[model samples]
Target: MLNRRHIRVKVMQSLYANLGGESEDFSKDQKFLMQSIYSMYDLYILLISIFIEVRNKGIDQIGKQKQKHLATKEDKNPNTKFVNNEILKFMGDNELILEKIKQQETIDWDLDSEYIDIIFKAIVSSNAYKSYMKTRMSNFQQDKEFITTVFREVIAPNDKLYDYIEDKNLTWLDDLPTINTTILKLLQKLRPNPTKTYLLPELYRDEDDLKFATDLFTKTLLNQNELNEEIKHKTINWDSERLASIDLVLIQMAICELKHFPSIPVKVTINEYLEIAKEYSTPKSSNFINGILDKLVKEYEADGKLNKVGRGLL
Candidate 1:
C-alpha cells in the first residue's frame, strides 16, 4: 500500500538521523529503516483490531444486561445490530488477520481492553450508532456504511486512542494518517464476502520500490562528498554550517535521484523534493531549495552533465 513518495519520506528520515556523520553501523541503520517501514503494517493491524475489540465489548455488555435482575424486555432482547455487524464479524473471524495479529506480538487489544472500552463507549454515544441500531436485520450495505462512519468519525479520532498509539510507538504517529486512509479505502472496496487474504496487503507495491528505498539511502550516504561539492558552489552566499540540516539532506537526496537514477525524470526529482520540503522543512525551504536546484540543473544541462534518459526526462 505504500507509494514511492512515502518510501522517499522514509529514506529521507533515515538519512536525516545519520546526517552528521557516517553511521558506525550501516547495517543496523539499514535494518532499522526496513523495520520502520514494515512496522507500518503492524500499526495498520493494531488499528483494525479496534473493531474486533469493540465487537467483543458489545457482546460482553449484552451478556451482562441479559443477567440483570431488573431487566426490561429491551435489555433481555437488546438490538444486536452492532455486535452482529457483518464487516466486524468478517474481520474478527478471518484466520489470516488473527494469525498476523498474534504473530506480530506487538499489538494486543485484550491487554489494552480499556482502549476497547473507551472506543465502544464513544461508538455507543455516536449518532451513527443510534441510526444504525434502528434496524435489527443485518444488511451488508448498511453494516459497511455504519462501520465506515463509526471508524472515520469516532474510533480514529479519539484522544485516548491517539495517545495510546503515540505511547506505543513514536514512529507510528506518522503512519497513523496513512494507515487510517488505507483502512477507509479497504472498507469502501470490501465485498460482502471477501477472501481470507483480502486484508493482508503487500508492503511495497513491487520489488523495484523495495530496491528504491535501499538504493536512495545508500547512494545518498556514499555520494555525500560529491553531493556536497555540487551544493558548495550554488550556496556560496550561505554558510554550509548555517544551512538547515533537513534542506541539505533533501537537496542531496534530490541530486542523488537526478544523477544516479537516470530513469527518473529531472522534473520529477525536483518536484518531489520541493513538496517534501513544504511539508517537512522550514516555510521558506521549498523556495530556497528550488532556487539552488534550478541553478544546478541549469549548470548541469549547460555542461551536458545531466544523464537523464527517456523523452522529456530533462
Candidate 2:
C-alpha cells in the first residue's frame, strides 16, 4: 500500500518531469501522476507473483527430471519442499490476488519468464533453501519463514530481477523500494491461516491520502510562481542557477504544504521533504533544503502565514 512519503515522491517525480517543458497540459500531467502511482500496484502484484512463478518453475523442473530416460533415484523422487511451500501455494490460489493479477496490464511475467528462472535458481541454491530442503518435515511457520528468508535474501535483491523491473517501467525504479519493503513486511507477518484478502491492501491508506496527493501536486504546480518567489526570498545568498532542480521542487512542495495544507504540521512537511532530498538529490541537498525551509518556517511563524491547526501542529 502507498504511504504519504511515497506519494510525495511520486508527485515530485511527476513535477520534475513536467517542469522541464515536456508537457504543458495540466490534465495530462495529472493523469500521468495518477497512472504512475497506480503502476506501483501493478509492480506490487508482479513482484509478489514471483513466488508463485518460481514455485511453478520448481514443479516443472521436477516433472522434467522425472521424464528423463536416465533419471537418478533422487530425480525420480526429488525433494519437493520448495515446490510445496504453503505461503507460495496460498498466494498462488488467493482469489483476490488472482483477480488483481488478471487486471494488471503492465506486468506480464509470461513474456519475461527468464527472470523467474533466475529467481528460482537463486532461491534453490541459497543456504536457506538448502537447509529447508534438508528436512522433509515443515510446519506452516517453517514454510513461512523459509519464504520470507528467501524473499529477503534472494528474490528481492536479485540484480537481474531489479534490471527487468527497471526496463519494464522507469517509474518502477522509484516504487521498487517501497513495494519490496511492503512485500517483506507482509511476508513477515503472514498468518498460518490467512484470509483470501489478506495480501490485497488498498493502494492508498484512505481517501484522505488520495486527496492529499492530488492537492499537493495541483497546488504546487499551479502556484509555482508564488512558491518560487517564496523560495527565492529565502535563497538570496545562494546562486539560483547552481541550485539543484530536485531541491527547488522539494522546497516548493514543502512550502505548498505549509501554506495550503493547514492540517499538516509545519515540522512534518519540512522533515518529509528533507528526507526525500537526502534520498533523491545531491549530497548537500538535504542540508540546503533544511536551511531554506527552517528560515522560511520561522518567517512564516512570525507573519502568521503558516496557519497550522490542531494541537502541536506548529
Candidate 3:
C-alpha cells in the first residue's frame, strides 16, 4: 500500500514527467505515476529474489572452487571464504525470504530481473564489501553489510531504478533522500537501532488502509464540481494550457486532502503539497498553492464542512 512518502515520490515523478514534456499528455503521466506507485511492492519482492540469486551464485562459485582445489595455509582466498562461510549461511538462515521469492513470479520480468542483477552485481563489486572483509569474516556480518551496501552504493546511484521501484511500491519513498548525502543519513538512521521495534504487522495494515483512503481521496477530488475551468480562471492568472493544467491538478489534489483526509491535519496537507508544488510547478507555485488551500480551508471551515476526527487534526 501507498504511504505518505510513496505519495510524495509519486507526485515528484509525475511532476518530473510533466515538466519534462508530458504536459500535453496528462494521461501518460498519470499512467506512469500509477505504475510507479504500484511497483513499490514488486520492488521489495524483487529485492528478496535477488538476495536469493546472490546466495545461489555464491554457492555455485564455492562449489566450483572446491572442485578445483582446497584452501592452503599460505594462500587465503577471500572469495572462497566469502562464499563458503558468509553467503551460504545467509541463504540458509533466511529461508522465509527465499520461500517468498520462490513462490512469486515477477510481474515485470525485465524490470525485476534486471534490477536484481544490477543490485547483486553492484553489491559484489562495491568498496564496502572490501572494507567489511578487512574487519569481519562472518557470513552474517557480510550479509548485513551487503544489504546496506547495495542500498547505499548501487540502488542510490540509479534514478531509473527509483522510477521502477516507485511504480512497484505504494508508499515510503516520499521522505527519502533525493541526494546521496540524504540517503547516507537515512541509511545511518536505519542502522539496527535498539529502540526500533518489530511492528511490521501494524505497518502493513496501516499501509493498506492508507492506500485505499488515498485512492478515494484522489477520485473524490477529481470529481468535484468546484474544481473546474471557472475556478481556475478565477483563482489563477495563468492563461496558458500547460501551466493551467499543472495548477489545476495540484489544486485538486490539495483540495481533496483537505476534504477527504480529515485526520491528516489541514496544515500538514497544505505543507506537504506546498513542498511538492515547489518541486513540481513554477518557482512561485508554493505560494500559489498555499494561498488557494488557505482560502479553501477557511471556506470549508466556515461552511461547517470540515469533518475531521481526532485531537489537533484541525
Best by lDDT: 1
- Which regions of candidate 2 deviate over 4 angstroms? 20-25, 237-239
**Of candidates 2 and 1, the better by lDDT:** 1
CA-lDDT, candidates in order:
0.89, 0.88, 0.55
Deviating ranges (above 4 Å) for candidate 1: 22-25
Pitting candidate 2 against candidate 3, the one with the higher TM-score is 2
Q: Best-fitting candidate, measured by TM-score?
A: 1
Give the local distance difference test score of model 1: 0.89
Candidate 1: worst-modelled 10 consecutive residues by lDDT: 17-26
Measured against the true structure, the TM-scores of the candidates, in listed sequence, are 0.96, 0.95, 0.64
Better candidate by lDDT, 1 or 3: 1
Q: What is the lDDT of residue 204 in candidate 3?
A: 31
Residue 40 alpha-carbon offset, candidate 3, angstroms: 1.5
Better of 1 and 3 by TM-score: 1
Ranking by lDDT: 1, 2, 3
